[model samples]
Target: MTAPQPNTAATAKARLFGPGGLRDEYTQLATRGRQSDSESREWSGLSVGHRMAMLLLAGVDGDLADLATRDWRELPGPEREAIKSEVRAAKVAFSRLVSLSGRW
Candidate 1:
């Protein structure tokens, strides 16, 4: 059976980036981590850094890292420009949402 998550994703994610009850969330994670033979004792805090670090440690950085470092000029001109434009638009859209309050 799946172990209980101390907080739901929405609540935990909110708590992580700001001040709330993420201490208890991480406490529960540590307990489950120990029970599952995972890292439990090394928790510092449940910040975005921790979340990103854990994602990177789990190899989530592989493809995205590769893509980020890729030379756009290596592709055919039309496709390269198209991709650059797409990425630029995506970046703009993402940035626009950064300052809004409450969930999307």
Candidate 2:
């Protein structure tokens, strides 16, 4: 039998969580948020907090999509609830981060 193929999504996630990855994205987002103004025409009028929150939500959705691709059976019950919890926590944390950056 051929060797099993690596999960590309997992590999991508590893890179995203590695040094100079998601952290760097966060830094850029914060910097841009701080520099944003009411007159700035970008992102269709979405605030920095809104943008960050959407980014956070996209990450969570990616995680769930990866899980689904691996095995849909793993998403039921506690696993699903855990993802929900993560979404809630991320929303709060992202909001706090944006607010702390004085962009809120």
- Runs of candidate 1 with Cα error greater than 4 angstroms are 1-71, 99-104
Prediction RMSDs, each to the true structure: 19.9, 14.8
The alpha-carbon deviation from the true structure for residue 90 of candidate 2, after best TM-score superposition, in angstroms, is 0.8
Please write out the lDDT profile of model 1 over residues 1-104, one tens digit for every residue: 99887668787676764432565457558787342222222222334454344334333434443433333222235543454455456567768775574575
Candidate 2 per-residue C-alpha lDDT over 1-104 given as tens digits, one digit per residue, 9 for 90 to 100: 99999999998886675545675467559887442332223333554465445445545445433443332122345554554566578778777675577854
Residue 50 shift from truth in candidate 2, angstroms: 16
Cα TM-score per model? 0.25, 0.27
Best by TM-score: 2
